[model samples]
Target: MDEIEVEAVDTLDPGVARDTAEYVLYGGKGGVGKTTMAAATALASANDGTATLVVSTDPAHSLSDTLEFDVPSRPARVREDAPLWAVEIDPDDALSQAGMFGQDGGFAGGLDSLLGGAAGDTAEDAAMMPGADEAAAMQLLLEYMDDERFDRVVVDTAPTGHTLRLLELPEVMDSMVGRLMQLRDRLGGMMEGLSGMFGGDDDATEEDQFGDLDAVKERVQRLRAVLTDPTRTDFRVVLVPEEMSVLEAQRLTDRLDEFGVPVGTVVVNRVMEPLADAVDVPDEAFVEPNPEGCEFCSRRWDVQQAALAEAQDLFREYDVKRVPLLADEVRGEQPLRVVAACLD
Candidate 1:
């Protein structure tokens, strides 16, 4: 495969730049290049002099491989030349360290003693809920958003199913927290009576436990607000040039709309374009693939064209960008720069 030498442009075209949002999230079906797109965008933004952090919420992390940087569990600079940082969040670790259910079972044991173990079990069950890992990962994302070290945060979210569940987590967690708080309120007198009987200082401990719950509720509200605010966030759906990918992107878009999260960009990755048209070159500088001579190329191009048509119509109202299928894997800064230029 012949490689095209992509020249470095001093500035991204203003009209094509979508880096205005403080938080940009790329999400779609699995293996559709969301990580590549997110890495490219973060690199571009950082090159443009913005302090950018690229975060991977997907359990199957690929940011490290895509950027060719050893990304840590916590945010760290990926490139010395550019203001770029990256982190592949470990959700389980985060959850364990979050103190959500209290440290060393102190609060949990207290709750159990107060309510005959039912309250503790309920709290533990909530913490181990279906989307608990995602919730933990999202909490880390929220913290990064507020971090003063970076001006912009690009998120490579999990695939469609996990992404949708992550979006729903704020409301689900908020409701759960509210119920727990209410329960605490109703059991206040009972807890006090029991504490006096056992000669334990349960009042202060219970107050502290409920305080943590209040803090979590506040953060959930803030996350929801940031997601819905168009100026602050942009949820970009990435997909490949295939019928199934297109349909999945559409479904993701619909769900994002339902969540009131701003969706302004749709990135169609791996679109089969003419080799000559895919890269920057002078007229007749590169030989174009003769689809007529290659039946497989011709058939694949036809399929891509059909999918592109449907995607264009489905995402007509949004800013749709197409990334031509490249001859090489998009790894390291150079390839990421090429992908970013294509994005422009």
Candidate 2:
């Protein structure tokens, strides 16, 4: 076994590792079965009778597809063993919600409407500006992660870059944001002040009443504490049995360590095996994934298996898990249930 995988395996809970973590963060490179795994894990937890919320933060969303449910703000109950709610948080919706808190013509609303709408998408202006989506989601998450909400949250994060952006934001307030802390609430309204600061006369909107610079700072701190508190957030990295996934997993490990989030384990998915050719098959090339007939199909299976075993060996230093590739995509309760059973 590789050193990294060894370390990761060591972190395994003797019995679910239940107390060590409350919220679980699943993230990795794009297209590595993360969404499926996150949904399945949430399903498992919810089945165990804990109130669970499975959330997707990825811009290029696939949670709905994976769950086979229309999860567009409509929290679908995937399992009845317990109360399980799933939400695909739309960043645009968050921005609109944030706008309601701003004074009429307030900087928060104008900026929010601007960010969540056209300007956020028009690559002609600049593709990176939609970063506000990440911020907006983080903002809402921070504001709502208190004791009143769900019991445990399962966060399906975006691809590497965007996930890193979210990680970086928690510390922004503690950095050099003294001016932000000085802004007032109630009598001292920054959003309202911002609208007028830009030389416009307008009263604050309903949404503005909920927002305060101090509240924002506090919110960031709360979220940072929630996610970074080692005992609260358990960060799991997912990868497929391929060179690119392995490379990305290693870097993700470094980033998690750097950010102070606890590393849980790595999941290696989609390792295929040899199939019998209808005509002539090698005696040694017998494996259950049995075969999708391509010219070099057997060799392809060998290479994939080799890569996966190599990953297991290479990342032995951390917790490493192997999941055979499913012949069909897993969607909805039945498939998710199958995955949970496999994990068991």
Candidate 3:
């Protein structure tokens, strides 16, 4: 693995400045500053005159608090003067709109009717199915991708597990749907042959049994194309300087590669600045002076330095950007701007 230097002006690095991808995804373990990085990127894009939308797909949304604005389910302006929009995807609402929870005209209803049953699977039960959240989240992302209002979309994705599920959903759903199509063809052919023997109508329309299957297949194909296309989409990994965070990020990067998504950048957030500049020390070690610093800060900084070196060695294949810890929590455009500057 080789490391490279990144050139930047203010908060915009060469990687971001030169990027033309339509979608940017930031994913990592929980509490790793994904939302902050995503928001800062979106804000920088808007400041650079690109129409951008920053969205949070995590169930526990922090976009609102991070931006210090009321973000609705639909895209709303985060600032009056800037060309930036923000929203938090509601999983239940997305599922309902996509017809995943429909009891009368959806998958559960059709299945129940085909089996001649009265009480079918409830919406709650359907929601509990494996990858349900991922499926809904994918639909929401597809909607934004199809929209032409924004030039770019920055996604603050869910934690590692859910994000991986979302990335793998397209292939899994495509295979399942392909099998269903084959079964439908076989059953339809058999039914028609039996009807001919009985002199019954062979052209009866039973398309309702395969409600929206074709559409679903097409959607999966489209999403797969965009996600796997390196020119259109890029995934960035964010982590703090810690053993758990570095290991998790490595695992996430490997999984993304399996899905054929590009992991172009790794952001090391909350890196500690050198304490030696702030605390003047004698040539020899002196432990009795409490005025200059405390033991806890020194110990924590030492640990952070070790973890930082480990992260650098582990992620040497990718472009790494270091962000120092801020004095104040990053909220609103001003604080986000500060972070963006540090990203360089």
Candidate 4:
């Protein structure tokens, strides 16, 4: 495979900017610094005077700690610019408001009860209800897409498995139907009237016979346009300098191509570059505190450089950013700004 190398930027030029990035999503393997990177991107958007919401979809939320402030499960202001907001969406709320065939009657409460008759064949076998999270998260994104209030929506997403499902949802909606409730609703409502008015043609197909929400399908297609359009939505994948992380990022790019979601960039976080004019490591031996009990940070960096070579080989068509390791935990505005500078 061909390879092209890249250095992380301090400020990205408009030449590489997405023309209509109303929605941007960050996804990759767990523990790859996606939350911090996504927060920085959203912060930059806000600094540019666009109203932006950076939402965390990771089951283990890091946004509250990252911002060094309280972020509500609902959307809340995290800083000075009225333009920027932070939220960690409640997955339960997304399902209830998703209006699943109106079975829940659009009530924000009581979705589990409402899902009574809607649970299909595979739901029972799904481990810890994986499919439910996909539905709920997609519903949340769809709800936001329908609303005109927010200028930009930046998602700090769950890991690749569920995140892929969330992005491909609108494309796959055509197949999600066991039965088209919209079709049945229309045909049942005016069956007798339409049959008489249109002259009971014997060879008519179901689509020809339907009259309700002919416009609705088009609307869903339009929504799909925003998600799949290259210049509109950018999917950024986060990776580290490790074997599995590099391989996973390569696989995810293939999947995104299959689903037709454009990848704007690849963010490779936590690099340990040799110093040009700065303080060196105090000792040659491994001697740092292991907060998560990961004692070999230098060894991790060695593995990462090899992985970075692999990433460069895999994503030659796209931009790959290398974010250096931070001295302290990346919390609050200062660290986030540091990261934003690295994304250029």
Candidate 5:
């Protein structure tokens, strides 16, 4: 493979600035550096004096490792001098804490009592429902959006498939809530008749059960609105410099378009660029690739350039940013700052 010379141009744009959107979401296939990008963006936003909270929705939880800090299940300030916070949401814990399945068996128990079943069976069934964990995670996300303490929220979403499900959850959950409401109405007359015979008031219990459902529906609606609003949310798709990753990102963007979500940026991670040209650092930190002499480096560089061309053309309508392949693992604040500078 011959040394291929490609022009380097600054791709960052003000429209996709870190502080432009109140909620910024980074998502793509696994191992494409989505978590690192989210962390760097959040760090940059906070350093600029914006109160920013970075939340991780990935079940494999790497945000804490990437940030080099212990992130609790709930939002906590991670830096004393900066207005930055982080949270790694545990889906099951979020659901339990939200009282979706309380000791009194909130949603599940209520439905079981109305339909006549074992006390815990309904709760178990609800837990087993498809996308239940994602739904719970999204519920917590909605709460965080309503949180007035932070000026911005950046999300590190799960891998491709899980992310699609999480994005689709609002509509799925809304339909489920609507069905439950209809079922309650259908059983309303029967409940009134039974109350008259048994001399018991079920109205209060019914009201409480349906009231929670109504609240959930309202929250889901709000989430949908925020997701579709370009000024409020910016969904950025991250990908490596590879053919498969670029194809996956294209599909993800298409799905987002179908869902009416606004995708404002595409991030190409680990591009093969000279270390000196990529980031400013001490001389010791430089580890430029010898593609001209090494056969393996030359081949990999050629492959990456091909994929980069495809990605650029496919995502031409959106702002695209590239991060150079780093010699060290991007873990601590210093390295993250370097990545943030690349983003700028």
Candidate 6:
């Protein structure tokens, strides 16, 4: 992680090896190639004969589109006998199972009864609040992490803002669960007292009522630990060669650092060709037939050059991988393998 000068290349270098990290999370601004990077990495891992599961936590769920395969909530193989699997998490289903409307019918149902059947809108609103999708996605990730099915997990996260919020969820949820547990205990104590006086069983059964809350709290703690552990987890950022993209990447890099997550590499996607350097001709002779032949390409190439330079300066301390803009859309395993080759 030294400050090294990075020059935009036509292809990507083999940055971080997949087997080394149990969980690799790719995150950045939307349309910055996060899904593409994740797909390529997973494809490479599968080619290496390692079992890999690529999970899409982004609600938009474009991993299916990128892979040109139908990805279900449960892991499905991308090809016959392939070691690769992919899934777009069903967020709403995950939330319902783990949220207040869970099997226990615990908090939400209780509120509905307490409010004399006026809890419909309130319960819906609770689910719509921020972090709901993150919590649900976390639950899905935890299940995969605990399963012995995949050797490694690659996460294609949501956009920058949503991804940051998701990363912060563990801490926020832990505190909230702790307070709720405390209140449940207090209520259980009073219930036990009343039951004893009413000649009911003296056993304190109410303590078991908060089992769902305890389960959620435990899962959050485990995920938090894994995320902060540098050896097991690495956060790789993806971005386009643009001023705004670089600034957002800088902010994400700083925030991940503050959260104790290790960022191994930054992938600068869709880098324009070095128009001047790539052409082998005299400056004067290259005029009309040059890369600046068209007005649009000329303006774009100029902007891209400045943004690329800025990215190098801003992320000098991290490994930077550049992916060229392909004329053909990157889709399916074959296309992803081409990208994987660039990454290699």
The lDDT values for all models are 0.76, 0.62, 0.71, 0.64, 0.78, 0.71
Tens digit per residue, CA lDDT, model 3, 1-344: 12222233243331233347789999999999999999998888877778889989998989999998888888898876778999899877676565542412244334334434522333223323345545776788898877788999999999998888788777766765665455556555432222221122446345533545567788989998998888999899999978889999999999999888898899988765521221222223112222237777666666667777888899989988876666568787666765565554
Query: Using Cα atoms with residue i matched to residue i, what is each candidate's TM-score against the true structure?
Result: 0.83, 0.72, 0.80, 0.72, 0.84, 0.79
State how far residue 170 of model 2 sits from its true place (Å): 1.6
| Model 2 segments more than 4 A misplaced | 1-20, 74-76, 79-81, 99-130, 147-149, 182-192, 195-211, 273-287, 290-295
- For residues 112-202, write the lDDT of model 4, one tens digit per residue: 2234433332222222233554556665666665556568888888988878766565545443221333334633533322222223344
Task: Highest TM-score: give the candidate number.
Answer: 5
Clash count for candidate 5 is: 0
| 117: Cα error in model 4, Å | 13
Give the number of the best model, judged by lDDT. 5
Better of 5 and 6 by TM-score: 5
CA-RMSD of model 5: 5.4
Task: Give the per-residue Cα lDDT of candidate 2 at 79.
Answer: 53
Candidate 4: residue 171 lDDT (0-100): 46
What is the lDDT for 224 in model 3? 88
lDDT for each residue of candidate 5 in 95-173, tens digit (9 for 90 to 100): 6655443423244545556566532433454444446567678879988988999999999999999998878777766
Estimate the Cα RMSD of every predicted model relative to the unseen true structure.
5.7, 8.2, 8.1, 8.8, 5.4, 7.5
In terms of lDDT, model 4 sits at 0.64
TM-score pick, better of 2 and 6: 6
> Which ranking of candidates, highest lDDT first?
5, 1, 6, 3, 4, 2
**Over the stretch 1-344, how does candidate 2's per-residue lDDT look in tens digits?**
12122111222121222323678888899888889888887777776767777888887779889877677753567555566778887877766555422322233334334334422222222222235556677766654445344788888898888888888866543441333223323224333444332333366563543344445556667777777787778888888877777888888889888988887677776655322222232334223443456547566566666677767776777666655555567787655654444343
